[model samples]
Target chain A: AQTVTQSQPEMSVQEAETVTLSCTYDTSENNYYLFWYKQPPSRQMILVIRQEAYKQQNATENRFSVNFQKAAKSFSLKISDSQLGDTAMYFCAFPDYGGSQGNLIFGKGTKLSVKP
Target chain B: NAGVTQTPKFRILKIGQSMTLQCTQDMNHNYMYWYRQDPGMGLKLIYYSVGAGITDKGEVPNGYNVSRSTTEDFPLRLELAAPSQTSVYFCASAGADTQYFGPGTRLTVL
Candidate 1:
């Protein structure tokens, strides 16, 4: 079984400030991919960043980066210089065992508010 | 390219009604998926297709059925609607680890 956990239900960050959203996952597989998706008012699921379990380096996308602790089963996202456009719900996800295209297991999600 | 497209942007159905949500991808990806997002929650997989004529159930498949006659299309069917079935349905196509999502369909069951 695979599970992803996002402990924060909601968070607020001022513009230009930084905020970090935490995520922890459980997976028996030695190789897999972890993802962060952003859902805004439009309800579109947008891929933010992804981290491979075998990689020692964390993944980064412009202002968004992840602190991936593979041994601790943790993958946390950090947004630098927050903007109002960053307000949305963030979800951590892991693919079910099989391959990269397997079913995705998602965390409940954390609603983020970027205050101007 | 139109990565993934879903029909019926929004719909309202009475209890016990039936409907089919359409999804099409122009990317010709061999892997496609259907997921539903309930209010205040993350998306849950309902079904997925590896290729033409190949389909499998996912995390939440009880109230839904799906078919993949061609690589470009994967439609999800709801035989009998219920209030609990109200959710935003998303269609996605993946070439590898990353999945490209459709805009989504918001369905309300009355």
Candidate 2:
């Protein structure tokens, strides 16, 4: 079984600053996908960024990026120029592309507070 | 487009009762998913559908059921509700790799 772990249960940062959320996973598969989904106060889960394990370069999306260390099974999210609206629960997910029934395995999440 | 919409933003039911959470998508997506998020936790997949007439159990499907009769709609059914079933349910529709989620249904089983 693949497990995604988010060690930081809660995090806070001043508005316009940067914050990094830690995530690690245990998977034997060499090829797969890692994702970061943000759930805002509205309870809408939105995809922030994604990275393919086969790629060495980390993925970046606007102000959201991921530090994907395939060898160490670590996929952390970095939020830059954070805004107050960025406050939410961020989940690190892994999609078992190696399986027939591909399902997302998610971490417990890190509740982020972008303090104004 | 409405993307994905879940009916009854909030619902409460008694133990042993039954109810179906409705989900519909307007983007003509082929894949739909049902997930539950407990308080202060992440979302867990309950069920998913590849297409119409094809549904499969996910990580936490023991206490839930699902059916997909049309490409636009997928409904999750709870035959016998329990207190443990109290959680926020999310419905999502995806095309290829990116998934679009609904506002979610907050369900409370008393």
Candidate 3:
């Protein structure tokens, strides 16, 4: 079984600053996928970014990026130029190579507050 | 396109009551999943279906039942509801990598 851990319970960042949310996982498989999902006040789960384990280079999308360390089983999400709209509960998730189709194991979540 | 729709956005039930959480997707996705979200805890898979008539248990399958009679509809049934079952339920559909999630149904058991 794979488990995702988000050590940080709550985080805050000033507007226009940068913030990093930490995440770690336990897994023996080499092929897998990591994802960062955001849930705003609306309670809608939105995909922020994703990283493939085979890729050495980190994945970047707009202001969201991921620091994926396969050896350490660590995949962290970084948000740059943070804005008030970015405030939400962020969750880290993982999908195993072989198992229930597209089933994801998620961390408890980190509540991010963007201060103006 | 109404990618995925869940009925009865909110509901309240008494202990031992039974109800069904309806879910439907218009994407014609082969895979559909049911997950529950609690305070401070991220979503946990309750049930999943690879296709119509094929359902499997997930991490948290107790107190829950699901059926996939058609490609678009996958409904979750809860029998003898308990306080522990009070949480937000989300239905999702996927093709390969990305998944589309519904607005979610919030259930309260008192």
Candidate 4:
């Protein structure tokens, strides 16, 4: 069984600044996928970014990037030039390589507040 | 193309009541999943199906039931609901790797 952990319960960042949300997971499987999802007040879950375990290079999408350390079983999300829209509940998720799809294990979310 | 859709955005049920959370996807995805999200907590998988007529238990399967009689619909059932079952439920579908989610259903058990 894979378990994801998010240490930060709540985080605040000034608009236009940068913020990093920490995440760690325990898994023995070598092939897997990691993802970052954002949930805003609308309650819609949106995919932020994703990183494959085999990919050594981190994944970056616009202002959202991930620091994936396979050896340490760590995958952290970094939001650069954060804006008010970035204020949401961020979740770290792990998906297995072989199984029924969409069965992702998620970590306790980190509620982020972007201050003006 | 409606990626994923869930019905009854919000509902309240009394103890021992039974209701079903309806989910549907039009992308012809082969995989469908049901997850529940607790406050300040991550989403926990309740049930999943790889295809029609194939269902499997997930992380938190107790107090929940699911059926996949067709490819487009996967409904979750909660029989004799309890206070512990109060949470927001989400339905998702996957094509290959990326999973698409619905708006979610918020259920409160009183």
Top of the candidates by TM-score:
1
TM-score of predicted chain B, candidate 2: 0.98
Better of 3 and 4 by TM-score: 3
Best by DockQ: 3
Report fnat, model 3: 0.76
lDDT of 1 by residue, A1-116 (tens): 67899999999999999999999999888988999999999998999999988899999999999999988999999999999999999999888785435778889999999998
Give Cα-based local distance difference scores for all models: 0.93, 0.90, 0.92, 0.92
TM for every model, in the order presented, reads 0.96, 0.94, 0.95, 0.94
**How well is each residue in B10-92 modelled by candidate 3, as lDDT tens digits?**
99999999999999999999899999999778998999999999999998999999999999999999999999999999999
Give the alpha carbon lDDT tens digit for every residue of B54-96 in model 2: 9988878998999999999999999999999999999988776
Model 2: residues with Cα > 4 Å off, grouped in runs: A98-100
lDDT of residue B86 for candidate 1: 94
Candidate 2 TM-score over all chains jointly? 0.94
Fnat of candidates, each listed: 0.74, 0.65, 0.76, 0.82
TM-score of chain A of 3: 0.96
The whole-model C-alpha lDDT of candidate 3 against the native structure comes to 0.92
Query: Which is superior by TM-score, 2 or 4?
Result: 4
Q: Can you tell me the DockQ of model 2? A: 0.66
Question: What CAPRI-style quality would you assign to candidate 4?
Answer: medium
lDDT of 4: 0.92
Q: Rank the candidates by DockQ, best first.
A: 3, 4, 1, 2
Docking class of 1: medium
Kindly report which residue stretches of model 4 are placed more than 4 angstroms away from their true locations once superposed: A96-102
